[model samples]
Target: MFAKTQAAAPVEAPKATGPAIVPGVIDFNVPGCKPEYPRASLRNEETGTVVLSVLIGADGSVADVKIDKSSGFRGLDNAVRTQLMSGACKNKPGTVDGKPQQTWTKVQYVWKLD
Candidate 1:
């Protein structure tokens, strides 16, 4: 039998280039994430903004959401958490090397009486 030929050289795999980049504060629009008015808060005439620390997954999904600052009303704070976890807050995640990545962002829910 003939001698075995040498193996082929190893080929490097292509790197993952993250999402496109835009200069100067690109508009990262939140698809459809609006906090609804909390029934309890509305009934009590509560008005304030709840700041939330949200973690978005690479696939534009909500990974985690927590209250960074309360709206001075426990009901409002709870409502914010509820709203976020209720699948209302979602946006395109940041990217690195053309690959999607998890990103942290802040979202404020303003509760005002009509």
Candidate 2:
């Protein structure tokens, strides 16, 4: 099971003033999905923000994930990757011209110990 990230907000492209850009409207806020801290990481008190560059397909599935930044712990990094690959961070794909289109987006997972 996974817990929801406190801030699931997305970093979307800027709005259109004139004509829309290749990077159209994107809803970075993907609710209901969050990365979970693995027990190993928790036991070791590992915490940091894992920045991810994700490629979302037209169907809203996570097609690929690249670690833009890591938490510096092997366990944490693996856990974050696993969580995302396992569909814990899936979201609705961004759209262009009122149609679902593949898009590149950034997601950050801040792991904290409580």
Candidate 3:
């Protein structure tokens, strides 16, 4: 009598660990590219944190910026928006599969005066 042989199980590929996709971020370490506290806001003593939804392109450019949470001061919010859109600083694009990809991320700015 012949003995029956069993087939080996198939091996599965290793899954990705940790975060699947990296979130985009705004880099303010560029020369002449720093967040400026709105002068009007400072004069008015308005201080608050602004939360923005920024869409950064794969090319590290600001595609779109929308205010998720306002700082209760239009001037302050607009200032941050303008600075980000000016291309003065670099925006780190999100990545997937180790490749740059257009992704939206949350950005926060505080409008405070010393």
Candidate 4:
């Protein structure tokens, strides 16, 4: 006699209970500022995207910037940092449970040749 096999149940994704904004993605109500990229090196002619991790302070300013993912170019990374430090990008402070709190954000910088 052959035994019947039972099907396994599908697992559901965990629901988010926090703010409506997606974690890591920039959602601090910040104004978009145009970023300038440095001239690309001759060796690497291909354009790439740089992912950055930014810490937003309670004062609605960028507290810190960390390069989570590099674009394989130092110049490009520096350019991104400079723009953030210059206060070019404006963002409202993040709130958690009705109180202002620091938040981490991931921003992408795309470098391409004209």
lDDT of each: 0.69, 0.69, 0.83, 0.70
Q: What TM-score would every model get versus the actual structure? A: 0.65, 0.68, 0.76, 0.63
The digit string of per-residue lDDT tens for model 1 on 1-114 reads 899899999999999886563211112245446566778778889899888877777776777778988889998888667766676555667665566777777767777787
Q: Report model 3's TM-score to 2 decimal places.
A: 0.76
Cα lDDT tens digits for candidate 2, 11-49: 999986763323222233455355567888778888888
Instruction: Give the candidate order by descending TM-score.
Output: 3, 2, 1, 4
What's the C-alpha lDDT at position 75 in model 2? 80
lDDT measured at residue 75 in model 3 versus the true structure, 0 to 100: 91
Give the 10-residue window scoring lowest on summed lDDT in candidate 2.
19-28
Which residue runs does candidate 2 get wrong by more than 4 Å? Answer: 1-32
> How high is the lDDT of residue 55 in model 2?
76
Flag clash pairs in model 1: 16-97, 17-97, 17-98, 18-97, 18-98, 18-99
> Which candidate, 2 or 4, has the higher TM-score?
2
Give the worst 10-residue stretch by lDDT in candidate 1.
21-30
Candidate 3 C-alpha lDDT tens digits along 40-98: 77778999988999889998888888999999889988988998888876867899867
